[model samples]
Target: MAFNGKFELESQENFEELMKSLGLSDEVIEKYKDQGKIIEIAQNGNTFQARYNYGSKVITNDLPFGQESEFVSFTGHRVKALAKLEGENKLVITMEGLTAAMELSGDKMIETLTNGVSTVKKIWKRI
Candidate 1:
């Protein structure tokens, strides 16, 4: 089970930090300031969908969805980076292209996050 809600920070500093933590450069933030359009839509009047928008475009994970690596790992098309809530704020981080088990009952979402980033770094060769 996962708790899905819209998480936004109320501080300028923390808000910038949140974007930075998600891998956006300072300049990028400035350009996209107030340009980030996130929407949490409802499905079947019972489920929610969280998505980020830039201008008129929507960002997505592009990970492949398969059963083999579905649990205990994060991967696939339509797969996206992860956003987590830390000590005092909500953070958006790249899913690192890893698909780990959905930690439904854990506050330490970063644990699963690291796996994706680590795997991405290790498997990709610099060209």
Candidate 2:
């Protein structure tokens, strides 16, 4: 599967700004600012399992394309989301107030998260 890999965070943009706009406390934001993050993805057919490792926390989501599923947001809230595959290398997930798109290019995966008010882009390298 194109999305199957263990990726380590390389760099990020607007992460703090987005978190701040989302009402996250400065202490919470600081806690995760320099945290090492890793994402492991396994895709089988149209179904995918994604594991996100953020130093002290690990969140996993089981997603089936075109179906609504329960997903945990970065804010640690459960939300109903629909996952969709765009072409062959991109997976887009839409939740109540957020949209996340993960696109694979070469050995890197670029994840863009938007909450209407702010946007964050994180680049990950396959490890």
Candidate of highest lDDT: 2
Give the deviation of candidate 1 from the true structure as CA RMSD.
Answer: 11.9
lDDT values of the candidates?
A: 0.33, 0.88
Judged by whole-model lDDT over C-alpha atoms, candidate 2 comes out at 0.88
14-43: candidate 1 lDDT, tens digit per residue: 334544665667887677555533332222
Candidate 2's C-alpha runs over 4 A off are none
Candidate 2 all-Cα RMSD: 1.5
For model 1, the stretches where C-alpha displacement exceeds 4 angstroms are: 1-13, 44-48, 60-94, 97-127
Cα lDDT over the full model 1: 0.33
Indicate the residue-level lDDT of 120 in model 1. Answer: 16
